[model samples]
Each structure stands twice: as structure tokens, then as C-alpha cells.
Target: MLVDQYNPFEGKMLQILDQEGNITDEKLLPEIPDEELVRLFKIMLYTRVIDRKALMYQRQGRMLTYAPNEGQEACQIGSVYALEQRDWMAPAFRELGAWLTRGVDLKTLYLYWYGNEMGSKVSEEIRILPVSIPISSQLLHAVGLAYAAKVRGLDEVSIAYFGDGGTSEGDFHEALNLAGVYKTPTIFLCQNNQWSISVPKHFQTASETFAQKAYAYGFKGIKVDGNDIFAMYAATKEAVDRARKGEGPTLIEAYTYRLGAHTTSDDPTRYRDNTEVEAWREKDPVKRFRIYLEKRGLWDEEIEKAYVAEKEEEVEQVFADIEQNGGTAFDDVFMYQYAEMTPILKEQYAEWKAFFQERGML
Candidate 1:
């Protein structure tokens, strides 16, 4: 197993693909079909396109504060590709790639960032939680989902995605501790992007590696090359397989770098240097994946130009639809709070209705 071979305690990280798209660890490379690989590459490309457009929208005042997944495509896309439809996911925001892969509608994602509740109104069949803004709280929710599945004798698994900063939160420790005792099928995916906002990871904890923390919780842990999709896929596949067999949880620390600011509201230039960003840009996930596709004769400049154009057009069209018809229903804000509105809610709703009516805006 990858966890057994890549000892986090020993500072051994699993890396199957290199920057030039060469298979650095042939033994560990996941056996992915050519068609599936091409599909995955398309999704990864779409993810980057969406992120770039989202950032542009935010700057143009068309969207709200956004988190850019500029360079972490492999970590999100590769790991999520390991999941089945029956599985569940709890994302700590910034997982644009995973959201798309899980069949979330573009309108839903945009509507949410458009500051509408409709975005969180995910189709029940998708089996994914809404974007989690509260640091490590989703870990607990994922654990609960896994535990419930365990008790019900279901084959479903639960995966939670968070950043390294979340590891410092008590909920992280609490969730892992609970999963450890219950032997739940939970996969804790930590995208160690090396920076949590302006705070570098060095300040978060003194642990040699985030994966090692799983040992403390009585489970296995593995560190992986977050930039290499092959490595992420291989590691997540093992974790998912183990979880399906009721072998308990595993912690996967995806060692990667955030090549963008923490959020649209923050300025990365204020804290980090261009030299650092440039260095990470050289390891951009999208570029390397494209190289891999090219190496396999699956992609070329003509194909990239056409595919990127199509993706960008689709992204723009989706956002345009959201702009035209994605406003959160006026009643949704009050109605979603409960099956039946409370008396105070009714009063407030009526008050707002009356105010809007007075202004002829209702």
C-alpha cells in the first residue's frame, strides 16, 4: 500500500510524476486508461478556466470574494476522481476542481459565490455538502457521515478536504480522534499548500509532516506529491479502498503550493514575494498535466487551444446564466431555516415584504 511504502514519519513523500510529465516512480503509477486520463485532463483544464474566470469576475465586481484554485488543480481533481457516486464529500471551500468533478452545476457554484443561497441548494443525489467556510468543522460532519454509513452497513465512504491550517484547529484533532475510536471509513485529505492565508505552514505546527498526525489518532498516514495527479490518484485510491473494507481512516497530506492569494480580498503580494510565486508557477498543476497528456499523444497545441476556448466559452455562458437568473429567491433566506417558519421569522418576513411592497420592489 502507498501508506506502508511512503512513510510520512520518515519524511518520505510519494511522487509518481515529475515536472516534465515523466513517470518518476513507475512502480507507483496508477493504471489509468487513456480515455479516462484525457477526461481527467479536460476536467482539470475546465477547473483552471473556471478559477481564472471567477477571479476575473470578482475583480470586475460581478462576483463576491473568491478563493482562487489557481495552482492546486491536481490535488482537488486527482483525489476526487478516486471517489464513487455513492461516496460523500465535505469541502473546505477552494475545491473548485472537486466540485465540478462531482457533477455540481456551474450555476450552482456561481450562484453561491454570487452571494445567493441557491448555490448551497445542491441536488440531494450529489451527496456533497455545501462549501464549508468554517475551517475544520467539515471534518466532524464527514466523520458523522462515515459513522452513520458504518452503522447502517452501507458501502459509502466520506472524504473531507481541508488545508494545512485546518490541522491546527481542535475540530481536526477531535474528528480524527473520534474516527480513530469508531473505526469509521473517513479519508482526511489535507492540501498542504504551504501557506494558510498569510501565515506560512511553519507557524501552524512543528510536526515533521501533517500525515504523521494520523498515527496519533491510531490510523495510517501518507504524504504525497500534491502537484502530481498520478500520485494523488494512487494515494486516494488506496485510502478509498481501505475505507470501503471498513479498515478505518487514513490521513493524506498532499504537499503542494498555492500559486495564488488566499482569497480575492487578500493581496498575496503584500506578504509573499514574486520570486516565491514564480517558483511555484513553474510547478503549476495544469501545465504539468498538459505535458503528461502531450507525452502520451493525447493532447497538442491545436487540441489545447480548441479545448481551452470551449471551456472558457462554457464558463462564460454559465456565469452569464447565473447573472441573468440565479438570484436567491426572496423567500429562501427565511424558508430554508426550518420546515416551518418560526413566529419571529414570519414577523420579519412580513416586515420585509411590507417594506419592499411600499417601495414597489417586491
Candidate 2:
């Protein structure tokens, strides 16, 4: 098994592609069909464009505080591509690439970030939870979902996406422990982007690698090259297969880097050095995947230019639509907290409306 072959405790990190984008071993390359590989690249490009435009909109005060997924595209898109339609994904807030790859609407993301509560509404067909902003809380929800699936005699695997910092949260450990003991079909995907909102990886944990933490909870752990799309896909596909076969859970620590600020409100420059950022920029995931596609004759500069232009136009229109008619409805704010709002909630919402009306601000 790939998990056994690349043992995290032994300090072995999987790297199917090097920084220069050359495949390290032909045998290690994932069996993604050529067409699907091209689609993955196109989606990754679209994700990057959306992320960049979101940053621009936030800076211009057209949106709320937003997280940027600049350098971690492969870590999300690749793993999500490995998922079958029946699988479920629970994502932390920064998983813009995964959100897009997993069939989320482009306008929904924009509306959500633009302070519209309606943006969080998703179709019943999509199996993604609303973005969990409170650290590693989503992992617990994923475990519950996985356990529920097992009880229902279904083989649908659940994957939870989190960051390196989330590993420190109590919810992280509790979720892993429960999944381990229950032998739930959960895939813990932690994007160890070398920082937990400004805390370096070394300070986050004394263990040599975050993947090693899985051993304490009784499952296999894999340390992988997050920037290498092939490695991410292979690891996730293997993990997904293992889960469906009732092999229990696996924790995958994607060793990636955050190329942008923690969020729109953050200033990475205050805590990190430019030289370090530049060094990681050389290993940018999007660039590495593009190089891989070029080598496979699936992509070129001309295709990239046209594809980027099309995505830019599409993103602009999505945002434009949101601006024109997608603002949050006043009633939506009070309706979703509970199936039926309690008297306190009703009073609070009504009191706010009365205040706004008194000031002619409603």
C-alpha cells in the first residue's frame, strides 16, 4: 500500500514530481486519463483566478475578509478530483479550490463572501458542508458523517480538509480518536502549509512531521508533496479506495506553503521574510502542474492565455451578478439559525429592524 510504503514516522515524504515539474518515477505517476488531467489543470487555473479576484475585491472593500488559496491549489483540486460523486467533503474556510472542484457554484462563493447569508445555501445534491471557520471543528462533523454512512450500510467515504494549525485544536484530536476507535471511513487531509496563521510548523508541533500524528490514533499517516498534483491525486485515490474497502481512516499531511496572507486582514510581512516567500514561490503548485501539462503536450502558452482570459471574464460576470441582485435578504439572517427561531431570536431580529427603521437605515 502507498501508506505503508511511505511511512510518515520514518520521515519519508512522497514526492512524485520534483520542483522542476519532472516526474520522479514513471511508476508513481497516477493513472488519471489524459482528458481528466487536462480538466484538472483547467480547474486549477480557474481556482487561482477566482482566488486572485477575490483578493482584489476584498482590497477594494467590495467583499468581506477573505482567505487566499494562492499556492495551495494542487492540495485541494487533486484530492477532490480523486473523490467519487458519492463521497462527502468537509472543508475549512480556505478551501476555495476544493469548493470549486466539488461542484460549488461560482456565484455562491462570491455572494457568501460579499456578506450575503444566502450564499451558504447549497443544493441537496452537493455533499459538502458549509465552510467551518472555527479551527478543526469540521473534522468531527466528517467523522459523524462517516460513521453514519457505515451505519446506513453505505460505502461513501468522508474527507476533511484542514490546515497545519488546526492539528492543535482539541476538536482535531477528539475527531481523530473517535474515528480511530470506531474505525470510521474518514480521510483526514491536513494541508500543512508550514503555518498556522503565522505560527511556524516547528512551533506548532514537536513531531518531525504532522503526518506522524496518525500513529498515536491507530491509523496510517502519509506525508506528501502538496505542490505535486500527481502525488496528491495518488495519495488521495489510494486513501479513498482504502476507506471504501472498510480499511478504516488515514491521515494525509500535505506539506504545502501559503503563498498569500492568512486572510485579507492579515499582514504576512510582519511575521515572515520575503526571502522565504520567494524560495517557496519557486515551488508554486500551479506552475508545477502547468509544467507537467506542458511536458505531456496537453497545455501550452497559447492555451493558457486564452483559458485565463475566459475565466477572468466568467469570474467578472459572477461577481457582477452577485452585486446586481444577490445581496443577503434580511429574513435569511434570522431563519437559518434554527428550524424555527426562538422568541429571543425573533425579538432580537425585530428589535434590530425597528432600530434600522427608526434611523431610516433599513
Candidate 3:
């Protein structure tokens, strides 16, 4: 058969937790303490709450477009929680899980969705780049950052987050090739959430698996059950350790699904089937992790109720602050663009201020 003679590589799929919240294997389990595992679960819960609220706000016209990361929480939280504070992360727009894990404030996150540039101005201590809107562009920035770290002999790795469709972009290949040539300590994280906006995964690529593409660039690639938190954590931990040891890059194709609409602007029902989404929902990352935690005596009804209530109050307060403050200033647009505003920009800024003042918005 033609398929038998020309196979380049087989994707190594890893799964530690089953869909029904049972441990399939003990050997593949991540070596995390119970306390740390509980913390990870809490982060996932917080992400779900934040994502759901963002959607509610979007529907109510309180916020702009937002990409919900509801089902892929494990893929994001497990990988980000494994990284050191000094490591760098370049995230695409749908990475609230990573942002929360990295300590980005809820207010700042909410402000971003409120169409404010001020929200993008994250503190340097977090070490996460601003969200990249253009698909696959963040990979190049990640490669540059990783190469710079290598040149400076810093023990840090730069992780680039993209979707399955992003792999088809030219920048994706260019970044991977450059990282391979320079042996940059970079981790290419492809959150294969099944759909890139409205495009299906099979239509995006003919390759059997996204992970196999890494071999062409001279790096190892592994596929993990993205909904399984333990599997995601183990794969990322291994890749991070390899990068810290000066080894070349690794490509991690997280085999997961997006259980929501692509964003507030696009509806998945037009192109995707309800059955497919429902099937993936059964493998929901947060629900699966919660079950695992409960089995290990790390979770209880009281704890769940308390945590949910706490996050709800916190998110409500954040929205209240945004509503009361009239959101971000219009000048915030030009202020972050340049060190010193040009004369034309200054004139435009003044015009905006006058317009707002006339309308009692100043």
C-alpha cells in the first residue's frame, strides 16, 4: 500500500485520565503533589467562570468580540502552570486560562474584552506577551524571543500558542525552521481545538497529525489528550525540561476540541454539528479534572460552592468597576503607540477629547 512505504512518523498520543474521570495508567501520571493538583483544578474552574461571564457580557453588548476557551482549559492551564515565572509565553487571543495562570489580573483581562488597549499593557513581571490577533504571527515573535534568550545564555524557553489552522500559515513553518537551525529553546504549543474559527481540522491539513510536522524541522513532537490535565502537564514538563537543558524545540499538538462558538462574532452551528460539540462536552476538561480531584479527596461540595461563589463575586466586582468607570479613555489608543505623540496624533487626541467633553463623556 502507498501508505505503508512512505510514512514519516507516527504521532505519539498520551492520555493519563480517561473520559469518565478514571486513571487509565499510573505510570503516565504527572508527578504533582495533591495540593498543586488542587490548585490547578481551581485555576481551571476560574477560567471556566471567567470565560462564561465574558460570553454573557458579549451577548448583553457589554463587551466586544471574545474567543471562549471553555473546553480546552486543561491544555492551557496544565502547560502554563508547568512553566517557571522566568519563562516567556506568547498567546493567541483565546488564552484566558494561561493569563489567569500567569497572574494577569481579572480587571485587566476584562478591560481588554471591553475594547480597551489599556488591558493589553500587562506588567512585565508576568512575562507574557500581549495577545496576538493575527493568526500564526505570535510564533515568529516567540522564536525571536527564544533565540535572543539562547544568545544571552538565559535558562528560559519561549512558548508559542496557536491553533490547528495556524500551522498552514507560512510564519509557522518559518518559525519552526529558524528555531531548529538555531536550536532555540522554544516550545510550539498547538491547541488543536478542532476548529479554527469555522474551518475544520481535516480541511486545514492533509497530514495525519499536526505533531508529525515537527520532524521535518528536526524536533520531537507529541500528541496528548488535551482534556486530560495530567497528560498535558506531563508532556509540557518533559518539553520544558528538555528546553532548559539546551535541547532544541519540541512541538506539542494538544488533541482537543472547542465546545463553543468560535467567538462572539461567529456561530459554530452554521458549520459544525451539535452532536460533535456534545461529544466533546463529555470530555470536558474542567469536569474531568474536578472528578479526579474529588476521587483523591481534594475536592468537596463545600469547597466547590465556596470557590464558585468567590469567583462569581470577584468577576461581578470587576464588571461593576468597568461599568462605573466608563471603560477606557479614547486617548489610550495613541498613548501606547509611541514614546512621544506626533503633532498630528496630538491634534487627533485633542479632537477626541473635545468630542468626548461635548458629549459629557470626558
Task: Say which prediction, candidate 1 or candidate 2, comes out ahead on lDDT.
Answer: 1
TM-score, cand. 2 vs. native: 0.98
Question: Candidate 3: TM-score?
Answer: 0.93
RMSD values, in order shown: 1.4, 1.2, 3.7
Write down the lDDT of every candidate, Cα atoms only: 0.92, 0.92, 0.88
Q: Highest lDDT among the candidates is held by which one?
A: 1
**Model 2 residue 23 lDDT score:** 92
Cα lDDT of model 1 overall? 0.92
For residues 1-362, write the lDDT of model 3, one tens digit per residue. Answer: 11112233653478889888899888667788888888888888899899999899899988999989889999999888879999999999988988999999998999889888888889889999988989999999999999999999899998999999999999999999999998899999999999998899899999989988988998778888899988888888888888889878988889999998888898888998899989999999988888888898889889999999999999999888988884666677888878899898999998988998999987
lDDT of 2 at 58: 95
TM-score ranking, high to low: 2, 1, 3
Residue 18 CA displacement from its true place in model 2, Å:
1.6
> What global local distance difference test value does model 2 have?
0.92
Worst 10 residues of 1 by lDDT: 19-28
